[model samples]
Target: MPPVKQQPCPFAPLIFDDEEAIGELSSVVLQLHDALSTNGRCFTTGATEEKAAATRGRIESVLLNAFCTIFGQSPFERFSDIFDQASYLAEHMAKDHIFEDGNKRTSLVFALSILALRNVPVVFPDNPDPKSNPYYAWIQDLVSGKRTREELAQELRSNHISK
Candidate 1:
């Protein structure tokens, strides 16, 4: 039998179907939904963590007022601004105890979309290697008060906007 050769995907520019690509998008949407619907339940199987519960309350209040307070604009802003806001919200929300599952995933998607809209250069892999990616730790640091908003903003500017 002759060996078969796979042709290049023409839609590569418009769409990506590799496991990484598919999982990348799915992870984002799933995480967002999970975080939103969790009702502040702790992700653990047994007793809920007190800090996590508190975080969830704080997250809900913030998400509810995200548009009015932070952006002072409608959610239907230009795609760029919308994305930036989403990213910011996702990052903040992930640190909170909003969902029993998928908080980080949700935040990552939000951040990626925001950067895409801003035309800022940010990198996010489909199967994110936590050891290499600074995103997860960044969010943790953010929640722990180790990283200030100004520092995060500066990082975004230096890494994405400036480039």
Candidate 2:
């Protein structure tokens, strides 16, 4: 039999990296969610440490599925814009079913941390009503594919969002 050749993925552009920093940040996000969620009943209160760790791992894995190229065992995306990267993180985390509770919230915080790491100042709504809050609507738009990653990045840079 002849050897088979691997082909490039058409969806490679929609991936992210599972870095140690993202993993650590996810742990913190999950911990905060567990603590503040539904008075500590957001479903993580009873989860074992192993379960929490596994969730963190899953979050990292989900983030690693983006437009990337592997080089010498290391994978990297084509773009390095801070706003773009951070926005994508939040967008993916929100869309991907990676948590039983506080998924979007955790993802937002996690993504925001990425911005903080680079000192990219951003403003976000503080649990506003979806009907009245543009930020909340923006998130909905993002999940629904109405808003592009670049759009979100622009919003973050503009600081038009309010808490």
Candidate 3:
């Protein structure tokens, strides 16, 4: 078969040095999950609340490992850029498939929420239907490794409020 075409990634990696920040991230992630559940979007496949909380805790641990450092060393002290942080949340949440339903939608909302927390004005193409938007396609491409994280970071930076 011909080589599969790669799509551009819409997120970049981030690193963290603060436990409080990690806690904040975990809280945000849980809040998103709860919100989805309230909206009838999240289905845990019959998992109990304790099980779900355990799963979320595991996710938080993984996130911390990916984004945090034990010592405030030279390379570890730097946190992920805002764009990268948002992208990481979006990509990982979607790719993990933790929720039985609406994982992608949840991921998108999480990403946007991260941006909003940073006071970044997120701009999207004026598309009424998400399935019809190129941005959605781009995110899929990113998840499939068709696009690089650096490219996503550049795109995000270009569209950020600072731009």
Candidate 4:
């Protein structure tokens, strides 16, 4: 009998290094959805639930596309690092305003989730108040184009988990 060769995958491997990381991403997405839907901390104005779900779908699509070597778009640019990818995700999600509300929170959550999946520990201010958290304003700056992706990446690097 002759040996058989397997064909390469049509798309590039996802940002995740392994199945566990992929699973973590899935779990975080679900968590974000639930937190937004019921937490009352982040709420959408008109067509709230539907828009929230839509945003979730969009996030899933973006993550999937990040794996594609050829056809993928958005955060999957060539020679980009994980920080750049995270910054892209965060900026677009907030700027696009996919939801009537909570876009900023969702964007931050997605970015942090991506980092966490990559084993990057992102430390925010100890203050639980959003107004007191510098990251909130910083993310807004990113969305508004006042800040560059490199700036976001630098911030992430500064706060990287020592482990």
* TM of each candidate vs. truth: 0.48, 0.64, 0.68, 0.68
Index of the highest-TM-score prediction: 4
lDDT tens digits by residue: candidate 1, 38-84: 64532534325785556445654544444332345443332133334
Candidate 4 — what's its lDDT?
0.65
Candidate that would win on lDDT: 3
Per-residue lDDT tens digits for candidate 4, residues 108-160, read 87887767766776887845577787888778788778997679877876886
Ordered list by lDDT, greatest first: 3, 4, 2, 1
Error of 1 at 110 (Å): 1.1
Model 2 ranges with Cα > 4 A deviation: 1-22, 36-45, 48-53, 63-77, 124-127, 160-163
Query: How well is each residue in 44-150 modelled by candidate 2, as lDDT tens digits?
Result: 44567787678777765655542233463323244446666667777887787567766666666666666665555576656544467666566678888998878
Worst 10 residues of 3 by lDDT: 70-79
Per-residue lDDT of model 3, residues 10-46, tens digit only? 3323455677877777777777777877877567566
Order candidates by TM-score, high to low. Answer: 4, 3, 2, 1
Reference-based lDDT, each prediction: 0.51, 0.62, 0.66, 0.65
CA error at residue 7 for candidate 2, angstroms: 36
RMSD of 2: 9.1
TM-score of model 2 vs. true structure: 0.64
Measured with C-alpha atoms, the lDDT of residue 57 in candidate 4 is 69
